[model samples]
Target chain A: MPQRMARVSWRLLLLGVLFCAAGLVLTARLAQLQIVSHGHYAVQAEDEHMGMEKVFPPRGAILDRNGYPLALTLDTYDIYINRKVWQDEKLAADGAEALSSVLGRRPDEILAALGPDTDGDALVAGSIGYDAGRKIIEMGVPGVKATATIVRFHPEGDLASALQGFVGRDQTGLSGLEADLQDQLGGSAGTLYFERDSMGNPIPFGYRQLTQSEPASDVRLTIDRYIQEATEQALDAAIEKNAANGGSIIVMEPKTGAILAMASRPSFKLSQLDLADETKMELYRNRAVTDLYEPGSVMKVVTMSTAVDLSLVTPNTTYEDTGMAYVGGYAIENWDFSANGTTTMTQLLQKSLNTGAVWVGQQIGPERFYDYAKRFGFGEPTGVGLGGEAAGTVRTSEDPEWYPSDLATNSFGQGISVTPLQMITAVAAIANGGELMRPYIVADVVGPDGSDETQPQVVRRVISESTARTLTAMMNDVVEGTPSHGARVQGYHVAGKTGTSFISVPGGYAPDRVITSFVGFAPVSDPRMIVLVKIDEPQGERLGGTVAAPVFAELAPKILSYLGVPPDAPALVQQGG
Target chain B: MSALDRLIARPLPRPFPRVTGVRPVLVGAFLVVACLGLLQVAQTSSATTTGYNLQRLQDERFATQAGVHQLEAEVAVLTSIDRIDREARGRLGMVPAGTALTLEVHKQPPEQQFVPLRFLSETKAPQVKTSSWWQRLLNLLPFF
Candidate 1:
């Protein structure tokens, strides 16, 4: 009995020792995990809890010459989703429906935009206005997030829509002056590293890291609102009166080459940009610098100016007009085929005689005349800092198929194309005493502060001062003397020319179709502004002198009055003379 | 004989094992080091989060300032007097009416007593024109 009792006691002792040993091993394992491997587990946990993202900085605004806002940024918002926070399919669907209703979109469309079964983080909506975003936040939908973004807005709506252009959804300039100065207008984006609470709300006194952000410099353009309005009104009136397709007008300071106003008819509204509307897109093209046209009789001024500059002819140099001039076996007739026995060079210009222009071209020859055209900024872009500028076509002397008829046709502004800007700028060169000032709309660039930096540049001198004076005087005769008599404004001496070119059709120049234009400067002695008015394919009165000249006359007086230019002479005397 | 028996009584004691293992001292040092490291990590994380928030607030303030300036510029442009005048006159062709052409001739003699009554009438009647329609109606109720 004693031996059996001792055996039971020994087995019990062994079981107790084994249990104690297991407890010691478990404690040792706990110490190793808590002390040695703690850092690895902690890092993994932090990665799951914390997140960081980069934030874009504020972009700058575009100002007019007078520090008025043309383009600016406004605070906007975007909607996002957290897949983990969304409790059920109903909650997700309801949130999307509420957003779509406020955004004026279909539920299915919003759903499609949110994408297919996103994991945790996904962008649901973009470019929502502040008020709409606020409303969505007020609703407090689970898993939905609202993020702030910057959006561009033009307050003036359609005013200068084509000139100032518009920005895209990504805040990049897409066209017009905006596209030309994109880098200067776009600021650097900054990074934002911040810790948030479990609810994704920024906690007070929370940890954050930020990089310094540089604001974009402001671009200041020289466009005047008043002059732009006047030009637009004048062009609109002319277009309506002529029943023409469309037209363009450009006004500039003759001496400075500062473009005061540039307008095109059928202008687009910045607020109503329809991407699918090709017709509206076509109107957005600035025809003043982009589209090239046969400048018609306006080209004769260049030819006449070249002749007088080279001393090939003087104001009194006489030519006998028998109604036609033959060049390369092709006969070019004067406008209306009016035959005059003998006419002075000045008289030929006053009448816009086609044959007379051809005679001057013949005297100057193709090479010299083409060089003069290039010097006057024809057949090239003006580098006006606007997108879609055209380098007009001027036939070269070295062309394989160069013909004398090409020169003759070009002399009267046919068989060659020039943009309205080129035509008007060349005229300004004559008015501004031969100095070919580089035309620019942007006057200066302003930094974040009020400080500004500007570099005024001039292109080159195209003609001698003496030649410019002679050309001005001869053009003055055209405005005041005979053909352009109707275009003379009261109490001001005007210098201008008229053009009525037959448009090119499938076969040849369309008989009934014409593009009439009038380009002129006011107070010829010291010109303040150069104005160009054009009308395309008028239903009636195809002559520039009859249609475009009256519009010029009406616009000039108002422009002069608005500019506060006192009358240089008595009204009746200036008008009658 | 009793004294000799008491003196002869004696006793023996059990022996004990020596505690010479290093486990207790090593565990104690590891626990102390882990507590100190945890405290340092918590402090660093808290400082980083606070610094990040401060910087983000500053950036937000700057952006708001830029926005305010931009809006002010826009307001100035939209309310410019020249732009308004051009739109009114050029687009609408509105001309101001001259007083010379619009003036009407009165064919009645002045109806009032001279001196004190004239002053009272002039002062009190001018208020009638500036009042609201309801006030004017209340004033005209006496005539009915």
Candidate 2:
């Protein structure tokens, strides 16, 4: 009996030891959960019970100068399909059929786009219309989901497409002013945190934190809706009439340097955007700011103005023209290749005499000519607040490839490249009493708090007011006297110059192609607007006065009349007449 | 006398007094716990209901915002220049003015003129025309 009792006691002692070990393990686990690993478990619990959501703000609208919406952001949806549901063939077919019906696509097409059966969701359609998306959601399709998204919509269609630019799939501005002023147009996104239930619904009385989103500022561009429409129509007509490759037209308020209308042809339609087509991407650029071409006789205006400002020559200053002027053994002749015996500075412009321009450049010399060119805002971007502005090339004497012929050619706007915006802004200085103004496209930015108006900014005084007036009179005479002057307004004194130059190729110049352009401002006394029209590779007529000046004539009269500037004295008869 | 003897002797006297089964402190603790449990249940029910209501309201707000966005898009399309031009040319039989006629009225220069808020007074200012209360009530009626 004593032995039996001893065995039982040993068992009890072993049981006690087992109980003690179990107790120690429990205590350690509890300590860890309550102390050492508390934060980890707590965070896991919070994650299960709490939720975070990113609150995206709406992108701003781009408006015209008259507060009409040019481009705006609108709510849309991205359709998604559950790949897990695709495992059930019937459900997948039903979902795809419903989506295809709403999206105007075949069910087989939709199914093919969804790919093989997978576990996660797949995007079926992006930027689906708002009404259709809402209808799909309300239909309660088993495997289909419509998630909210935003898309940029241009109300005016392709009116100023290149200037307004466009947004990508993520609603980010990709080009043009839309890309340039992204900061102001794209507002800051916010975050929201709240406690959620098992089904991911917010708990009514649960803790909530919110970081309020800042709304985007509405940008008002200086583009006048009517003017822009007219400019586009005119450009389209000119391109069709000339059977030309492409062209660009820019109309700016001379005094303020406000771009009223900017249009480029070979532009893609906004309603017909296809990102897959890489070739059309080139058409998406605003060529008025991006394309560089020799301004031809347009630069002669700059040269003549520079000479007049320096007192080196006047409109009456006489130069003997033998139909050819030789510099570095390179002969420069008039556009018609027939020069008058003794041509006045005014008559030089009337005839568009390249020989006469060369003579004037010789008088001013290379150093002062280039200096004045720089002063006139050439060889630099006009700072027009547009993306992809080219600071035109000017090969002055400082460069290695400089030649004496370059000086003569550059005088008449060859061997030099300039964007249409730069050329217009340069001539606008002559119209603005020689004060170069910084050109701007955006006129106002209206935010939630208030509106900010962009005040007119004067770059600098490049030439004297007297010289500007004298050049204006001379240009007016050129317009009135030239036989091919199609830029004349019925009852206005138009100051203008025509340009026609051969397009430069790899080695020399394109044999058959020519770029014709016209730069003009109307009502010579007040000079409210400046217009530049450039056409590339016309099939038949190629002279600026013939091809490009007529386009200016078409758009300018309408613009001036729209501005309510009463007509000045009636135009004078042609010199030939 | 001894304490045990006294107690035995005292209990036996008269009709024997019965002792209560429950202690006061235990009863008090039970009552307190029950009340607390009921209160917790009530608060949870209220909070859950509120959460559902808040969700519904948020959904409504989102729907309204979406509707506003839709209307804005529609208005933009309708007012777009392309649409206007098409409607004017095709539907309304209207053409753009071929000749712009200018009539220069003799008036004060822009700097010297007080234009007299013509646009505001003509278009925006609310007209304070005399109206009977009966007419106003009639105007509120859909048929009227």
Runs in model 2 deviating more than 4 A are: A1-53, A93-113, A129-140, A192-210, A570-577, B1-40, B103-144
The interface RMSD values of the models, given in order, are: 12.2, 8.5
Per-model TM-score versus the true fold:
0.75, 0.83
| Residue-level lDDT for A258 in candidate 2 | 97
Q: Tell me how much of the true interface, by contacts, candidate 1 captures.
A: 0.04
Per-residue alpha-carbon lDDT of candidate 1 for residues A398-429, written as tens digits (9 for 90 to 100) = 88777879999998899888898888988899
Give chain A TM for each model in order.
Answer: 0.82, 0.88
> Alpha carbon lDDT of residue A564, candidate 2?
76
Report model 1's TM-score to 2 decimal places: 0.75
lDDT of 1 by residue, B54-99 (tens): 6677656745665585566568656665667778899999984331
**Where is the poorest 10-residue window by lDDT in model 2 chain A?**
A568-577
For model 2, what is the C-alpha lDDT against the true structure?
0.88
**Per-model tally of clashing residue pairs:** 9, 1
**Per-residue lDDT of A510-566 in model 2, one digit per residue for the tens?**
969999999999989899999999998888998999999999888988998889777
lDDT of 1 at A149: 75
